[model samples]
Target: MQALLALSRAIDRLNTFVGKYSIWLIFAATFISAANAVVRKVFDTSSNGFLEVQWYLFAWSFLIAAGYTLLNREHVRIDVLNSHLPKKVQIWIEILGVILFLTPVCVLIIWLCIPIVAERYATGEMSPNPGGLIRWPVWVALPAGFALLLLQGWSELIKCVAFLKGLGPDPTVKADAKSAEEELVEALRQHQAAAGKAP
Candidate 1:
């Protein structure tokens, strides 16, 4: 049990690190996109590579952060139905969901994507656009992302089982950490308060 918990914690840390750094990809994508637009407007020219790279970065960020999102319990849920359920029931549902749905789905995706990614790499596939980037890097993300998700699913399953066995904290309990939207709202409120105080 201790070993399992340690493994789960390790997976959590890995996903956390990936998620934190992946956020920078968004800024990179935005900056590149703006730069592309500026160059296109100023020089009356553009490269498909720049546009494609932005898409690649966006995809990388979204796909890589999926496991981290799950780890933080930030994935979308039917809260209206779930919040009213008993804690034990909720834990059971989580266990079942991870075991039955999340695990299988991620596994299947990883399985399917492996061959495709291999083919892309073997063929050295490049985008149809003349200046666009190679296709394999983006193709590889499919299996890589799903593998991370699969690992996180296993971690979540362990936590759920531990909770049910009374050996760990409640897995269903919401963390105190605020959502991005909530954080944004709080920041805006603080800015407004500061402006009012400026007078």
Candidate 2:
């Protein structure tokens, strides 16, 4: 159990590190897109490679960050009934979800994508659009991303089991920190209150 928990923590750390760095991919994509537009307008020219590379970066960013998002519990969930359930029941439900749903789906996607990426890479598959980027780089993101997500699902499962055994803290709590949505709502409330008081 201790070994499993340690493995879970390591997976969490790996996802956190990857997620933190993956964010820069978005910025890079944005910069490239803007530069492409400016160059097109100013020089009356453009390369499809520039436009396509932006898509590649965006895809990689979104795909690789799945595990990080899971780690942070940022994924959307319909918790109308869930919130009313007992804590242990909720943990059990999550355990079932990770085991039955998340694991299989991630594994399937990764399995399906790996061969396609390999084929593309071996064939040196270039985009049909002239001056465009290679296809394999973007294709590689699918399996790599899902593999990370699968690891995260296992980590989450471990945490849930540990909690049920009374060997660890609640796995469902957001570690006493407000979520991004909550923080945004509070900021809006404060802004509205200040505005009301100003009048």
Candidate 3:
């Protein structure tokens, strides 16, 4: 059980690291998009490469951050009924979800995508658009993201089991940290307070 717990922690760390750095991709995409728009309007020129790169970056950020989203318990859930259940029932539901649904779906996607990505890479597939980027780089994200999600699913399953055995904390309970929206609202309030005080 200790070994399994260690493995779970390792998976959590891996997803956390990936998720933290993936935000840079969003910034890169935004910058490239703004630059592309400016260049198109001001210079009367644009390239598909720049536009496609932005798309690629956006895809990478969205795909890679999925496991991290799951880790933070940020994924959408219809807890209207589940919320009323006992803690043990909730944990069991989570375990069943990870085992029966998440794992199989992730594994299937990863399995199906490997050949597609490989073929694209081997063929040096390029976008049909003039001056567009290679296809394989974006294709690779499919399996990579699913693989990360699979690992995180396993980690979550382990945590659920550990909770069942009374060996660790409840996996269903969310951390006490504020969500991004909550933090943003608080920051806005603080800024308003500071501005009022200054004037």
RMSD of each: 4.5, 3.6, 4.4
Tell me each candidate's TM-score: 0.88, 0.90, 0.89
139-191 per-residue lDDT for model 1 (tens digits): 88888898999999899999999988888987675567677899999999999
Instruction: List model 3 lDDT by residue over 46-114, tens digit each.
Output: 999999999999999999899999998999999999999999999999999998999999999999999
In order, how many clashes per candidate? 0, 0, 0
Model 2, range 104-199, lDDT digits (tens) per residue? 999899889889999999999999998988899999999999999999989999999999999998888876588899999999999999999995
Q: Could you give me the TM-score of model 1 versus the true structure? A: 0.88
The TM-score leader among the candidates is 2
**Order the candidates by TM-score, highest first — what do you get?**
2, 3, 1
Give candidate 2's TM-score.
0.90
Model 1 CA lDDT for position 182: 96
